[model samples]
Target: MFKKLLSSIGIGSATVDTKLTKAQYVQGETVEGVVDIRGGNVEQHIDEIYLALVTTYIREIDDKKFEEKAVLARYKVSDSLTIGPNETKTIPFQFALPYDVPVTVGTSRVWLQTGLDIKMALDPQDRDYLAIEPHPLVEAFLEAVRQLGFRLRHVQCEQAPRYWQRRLPFVQEFEFKPVSGPFKGRLDELEAIFFVSEHGVEVILEIDRKARGFAGLLSEALDMDETLVRFTYGPSDVASLPQRLANAIGRHS
Candidate 1:
């Protein structure tokens, strides 16, 4: 089940419209958009008008799986007010995306949604969709990985859950393949998790080691040990990727 809450007074409901200014953005970039609301046929006393920034996540609990739960970024776009019949209002919003905003490759399933709740007699809902594109720097980084002979296996968007942090509602994980040379023989699989924030991006990498008893998926290895590494990146530039990845590998070694 998805998470939601709504409360509307006894009058009429209001309609909501949301528009995003750009289809493409970077990890550390800002998103510009607007929310427009129109009154319905009857006058309504609205307790509050607000917009929420939400991302979908996949979660497993007690061996059960769920998808596309809403995450709240902010509230309070407007206070309590009464809108007369057939009235229209507009609100502008600027959202600062975290530096670790996950990169989407191909036609992945992800959404940036604006949800509005109108307090008429009870709360009614309105929603709008926006197109999200990879930032230039993020695309460059992926290109670099491709240059390094890595293939993207799968990519997904998920929420952090209550265990990690109060504010970190969403996270993205990318699985990749290293099919040649030294890495193929020693590593079974590589997974990258991105944690984006205001200041910079935190990259958590987990490489599954080839199990000794059984030859691992990517390569065959005997007496091997698994290793984990963390890397930090910012500015969303192409030039920084090689150096940063190299530095992280070196530190792990």
Candidate 2:
């Protein structure tokens, strides 16, 4: 009776802990880990195990700030199980992170949420923050953008609207503003949105340029009509990337 009461209140319930091979991983790579479950003060029947990739971001509407969670991926680890008291069970798992997953760059973050569902008790869970880095080509492209005098301003992952055609439910935006060269005063900001995959990368650059002429007058007054440019690249383009980036951003004819 005491064991049942304690289990009902979660004192003698099953506990879950997830262990990953490393703290850092590259986008689109596989993460190998194990979900370890240990029986508490009494033996318990385990129903299911769930693991989720999660991240949080801030959104502003009017004068209010809302913190929201984006579930990148979720999966089941086990079906049914019975454990003896003081026994430890390990379930191995491998998750392939989506290529477009928001990396732990600047203020952005990604992590895993693990849950153990007890048959007649509250579910116990765990969370582990992961360090996700951009792929090699993506990193090179970002470096090229930096060499072009665009200083990174902000980076955040937000819920992607339908038009973006994102693989995951959300998308990350890396915003930059010019600090030197021809685009300095003429451009307001340049935002980079990446659509990454195992094969290559697609970049969408949203150029917020200062308007010019009479049309500039109307644009400045209306606050609309930014420019969008898209490009696809592979590892071979790394060497001449800066020049290509400069040309794409209209730095030269």
Best by lDDT: 2
- Lowest-scoring 10 consecutive residues by lDDT in candidate 1? 1-10
* Global lDDT of each candidate: 0.59, 0.84
lDDT of 1 at 45: 66
What are the per-residue Cα lDDT tens digits for candidate 2 across 21-89?
A: 998998888999999998888888887898999987666667687778878888888998887888999
Residue-wise lDDT of candidate 1 within 1-253, one digit each (tens)? Answer: 0111222442345666777786676655677777677776666666666655555667776878688655445556667777666798788778676554445453233345544545325555556543455555455556656655567888886656565443556667777777764456445667777655555556677666655444442343433454667766668545768656645543532
Query: Which pairs clash in the backbone of model 2?
Result: none
Candidate 2: which stretches are off by over 4 Å? Answer: 58-65, 211-217, 251-253
Position 151, candidate 2: lDDT: 90
Error of 1 at 8 (Å): 7.0
Runs with alpha carbons beyond 4 Å of true place in candidate 1 = 1-12, 100-117, 134-140, 158-166, 180-182, 211-225, 234-240, 243-253
Tell me how many clashing residue pairs each candidate has. 9, 0
